[model samples]
Target: MALRLKSLTLASFLIPSNRNDWDRHLSAKHNRILIVDDHQDICASMRDILDDVGYEVVVTGNANDALEQVDLTPFDVVLLDYQMPDMNGAALLRIIKQKQKAVTAFLITAYAGSTGAQDALNIGATAVLQKPINVVELLGYLADAERA
Candidate 1:
């Protein structure tokens, strides 16, 4: 079955917290992605786009839950929102990198020239994409990630 996750809010799942203990769950055939944003509509739009292209997508509205999901499963790429209530994209990208450095991350933000976007890029984000994303460009990024 095609994996599709939408707006997961529950907590309390456990996986290895350290990268050494975690196993890469994705295979060559599985192109899994995680979408983290506070806005449900944004997540839904991204999910629809990715799912249509046959990617396994999971989305969460909060950073903590996104972290938990990352800990549990290996994702090829992460589309992270730049601003959220609990944490910013840069901070979340740091944690995600710590968990799995191989994962490609893109910071999604309306404020492309802001400090946060620069910070995210500094911390190893693959790219910083403006909000109201262009589906063609986003898919191109995903295609690149899939190749890597």
Candidate 2:
């Protein structure tokens, strides 16, 4: 697969002043994150968001590929979208936890207030984030996960 860069508006997520802040709080080894989302733009946007902040970011448009990436890589954390065409995030998290119990995972979704959040958490998500994720909250979670 080819790795392509997406053009994005950086200001929408990361503040110029805080761009280096994420790196300051966490090292590159502890900052790797895998993002699984069916929407190409969302995946690209998130990849850019984390990448700009100095974290290694990997993204996949489907659950199958995301699973393969997990098996092949050693990501410290994952931010998985709740909805997808092939498989739901909860199912993916279950498989990941079964394969690697120590892996940290978080389910991200617009349906955060719904039962899906509970389902994902019950399955194995270390945490859940409401969609249109708050940057500060996400950074806080990543920082905490880095320490753990």
Candidate 3:
């Protein structure tokens, strides 16, 4: 079965006031995440899941718009879809990495093949996920990223 991230809409959560513990779980400084996919539903779903988890989410449907947004804002992480109409995810990732060497990106796609995964990673994506995405796993990756 494929993973699906269903939770959407951000809400206030009761968190401990302890500075260290809260910082470990989350920061008042929310991480900015950019989602690049041609599918609106996929973009919205990802935004909703990450936003609810205390990330500032931005969504774009095309490579051009994604490039524009990234140029304007600094994103800590980018979620890219492998197949796109104007330009594929690999090409976009190359550009993104060139523009922001420090930004971490993950490629999301239904086509999970050795070649595809390697190509994405070779171009500097932090990881590749097979769709539909599992929210729990994504959070795990984010947690690891926070620690790194």
Candidate 4:
């Protein structure tokens, strides 16, 4: 899939100017989520769904960029693909936890029985979501995360 950029005004998301501003922004109903998947189509589709529902969405195809974004911004939730060429989602979740334990992380995979799925749960993933996720369930998780 080709890489495509979709822009949303930063002001719409209310980019925080300081720590207090960030805290308030996070407490608002409009939360931010990060989608880390190797497939471009998956990222785009997920982003569109979340964006339509009033969440700020950021996506990347690699763990490195995901980690950088995690450091730079506070995400209410992270939807991570379980399989990746560079690193598995479980390992990436560990790194994200180390960086920000407050960020809820979910593993997305077609293979629920895969060791990576078990590892992700063991390493503190909020949940493991099977591929072709139920939009209602996904939104429920996001809502719960936002409330936290």
Identify the leading candidate in terms of lDDT: 4
TM-score of each: 0.79, 0.80, 0.80, 0.79
- lDDT, residue 114, candidate 3: 49
Model 1 residue 35 CA deviation (Å) reads: 0.1
Where is model 2 more than 4 Å wrong at Cα? 1-23, 26-28
Cα lDDT of model 3 by residue, 63-95, tens digit:
999999999998898888989989888889999
- Tens-digit lDDT track for model 4 on 29-79? 777789999999999999998886678999999999998999898787898
**What local lDDT score does residue 26 receive in model 2, on the 0 to 100 scale?**
47
Give candidate 4's TM-score: 0.79
Scored against the true structure, residue 106 in model 4 reaches a CA lDDT of 84
Measured by TM-score, how close is model 3 to the native structure?
0.80
Worst 10 residues of 2 by lDDT: 1-10
Q: Which residue pairs show collisions in model 1?
A: none
**Pick by lDDT: 2 or 4, better one:** 4
Question: Which has the higher lDDT value, candidate number 1 or candidate number 2?
Answer: 1
Global Cα lDDT for candidate 4? 0.77
